[model samples]
Target chain A: MKTKKSLLFISYEEARHICDKIQYGEATRMEQIKLFIRISWCNISRKYTQKNTQLTTLCQSANLKSLDKDKKDSLKKMLESKMSESKD
Target chain B: MSSNTLDPTQWIDKYADYLYNYSVSRVSDNEIAQDLVQETFLAALKSSENYKGDASERTWLISILKRKIIDYYRKINSKKGKAEVRMSYNSDGDGDGDWMEERISDPHGNNAEEKIQNTELGLAIHECISKLPPKQAKIFSMKTIEGYETETICNELDITPSNLWVIIHRARTALTACLEENWF
Candidate 1:
């Protein structure tokens, strides 16, 4: 049985590092457990995780506008012409 | 059905908006997005013979566009000199990752505040990413924004997993600092 004294409480640096590994799915099971234990009580690390999640979601959902019709038509003409040139 | 094959001419009208939106979201540059979509069309035409009709034309085009975007990142990074990836920690020499503590705080707010904040938050994030040193920006985008797997990123950028972790850590910390200065 793992003794309470032997259950290593990680440092802030280690906890953040493991949090990153967890984000990338790179942490080992034991590392994940340690990270979870750390974040459960560590408000700072929990905030880090929340910010990381927010950043990832913001990036994934970045709403970018599309080209207008006139621009699309011109680009299509250019590409089609280039296609024909390459074919010949 | 008048035709069994997808008409190539109709691709722009049918899929240009989709391709543009996808490209712009990833790259966040209108000209590059337009160029990438055009390149996708050209590549599709070049590889038209490879189309077996198993996937719809739109799917095939998207696949090509995705590859094009990856290639664009690879090509741009290739032109810069290959520097060894190094860890950027606090200059105080503690290596504790404590440099970010002063700069970042909880950005959370009431729902109305969040709604008002998120628009500029998006622009701030993009601006902060663009401010990273070129290689870090590229690697960060590939790993975080583009969602490339870690191993693939390591192989493509010729860095180890540990090195990537350090770079990503630095990038995120830098972004937090930037966001604090600009957004918060």
Candidate 2:
């Protein structure tokens, strides 16, 4: 009884977190298997996993890019100076 | 009911990715896009008084950025012997963004049609991301859009791996729900 309960004990939040890790290619094989088992029985987990994968695929296709930290830092400094100059 | 506020200190942190994506879609040049984002911030600061708290700051910044992009083209047009044809897009016209986008070739293995669609889809994704709570938006952009390593994000944000994962999960839930109406 204890073993069975332990096997099925994963919370939905935990399962969803694992889903996120899997999407990012960060989940370990053991973690992957745990998620696989959870999704096998939990309809909510399965649905979330599907939507999560679809979201990743869509973002991947979108080819989004981020402004790096160095540029962002420079922009911030520029804005600071401009703000001060405007006030003066 | 409109209740939005502007905070310049938070601008770079919150809206930089959003504006970067916005400008990249229009300009199609990475360095130029980053410069435009910077200019957008400076311009917004100069005209900060014009913001009446009605529109969200992101919307207002985007509006300003749109004008700046147009001006960028005008500047280039005059520099190139003033004979360069200025391309304009009819937002509602059937021909698509005929003038500008039709000219720039995408080097990222995307054909023109796919590039245009991806731009729209990218903007839509950013729009949904912009609606997330600030931390979640930042985390999602860094991890997913920026493609930062998990450890790097954890170190920068001072979050544990599990904390980041929780935030990612919540952000994904919101993003998926948001995107489902227009995309799936």
Candidate 3:
């Protein structure tokens, strides 16, 4: 009779074969899930970085366009106030 | 970001489909899988500074995504506090008890050879992996499916070497048992 450990080891090899199928996209649901996650990640990351860059550019441009030093200072002060409020 | 910067965009084209398919295999939900992928990308972008180029960009991005998925489950489970309740399969209109019975059926019997042939063994294995305990399943997928090294897996999971091995061993054992009973 085969030892229990040997039986388990054989079973593990079988399981690994099944997993190999999944890794290779031979599995249906597994393939779908992997595809969905990848697309979602790409979409989200691209959008987030794009949005952040746009916001940063807008901030910079607004700051640069301000001719009045007093207005620029006030804008900085407002940003500081908002930052402090967020901390609170 | 500078226009001259090498866009990781090329990486997305090559790895996005593969990665998304991998995530979807684990989560079994399209929307959530998509969200996880997006989170992975956003993480890569934010932490692009920390990526030391030791691993391929694909590997690094996947590591981040895996962490995000774990965090999501942790948050959800904390609020639910009822693991048993979530274990059942009710949302698909199939009774949980019946589903469990089906899940436990052997697919590789002499008469069931056709079923095994028609139904891809890989898909069956994917389902079996999905049924594993949450942490074990994640660890197994990261190691077995994603091909991450033990050291990287431990670091990403914040687990000790022993803990990682234990989880992997258990996960493999459980999957094997489940497959033997249900498929082979």
Better TM-score candidate (1, 3): 1
Please state the CAPRI-style docking class of candidate 2. Answer: medium
Rank candidates, DockQ, best first.
Answer: 2, 1, 3
Assess each model's interface with DockQ, reporting 2 decimals per model. 0.15, 0.76, 0.02
- When summed lDDT is taken over every stretch of 10 residues in candidate 2 chain B, the lowest stretch is B96-105
C-alpha lDDT score of every prediction, in listed order: 0.73, 0.87, 0.54
lDDT of 1 by residue, B1-184 (tens): 2223656777765566567766775676889988999889888887887888878777788899999999988987886547666755547666466557644544453654564455455555666765677667666766665567989989978999889888998888788778778876
For B1-184, candidate 3 gives per-residue lDDT tens digits of 3222223534343344345555665576766766676666656665667767677655676788789889878888897886556454555765545775677777665645643342344444555655677678667666655557778888977999668767765765676667667665
Classify candidate 1 by CAPRI docking class.
incorrect
Q: The CA-based lDDT of model 3 is what? A: 0.54
Candidate 1: lDDT of A33? 81
TM-score of each: 0.46, 0.82, 0.33
lDDT of model 2 at residue B86? Answer: 84
Model 2, B20: alpha-carbon shift in Å? 1.4
lDDT of 2 by residue, B16-45 (tens): 888999898888899999989988998899
Per TM-score, the best of the predicted structures is 2
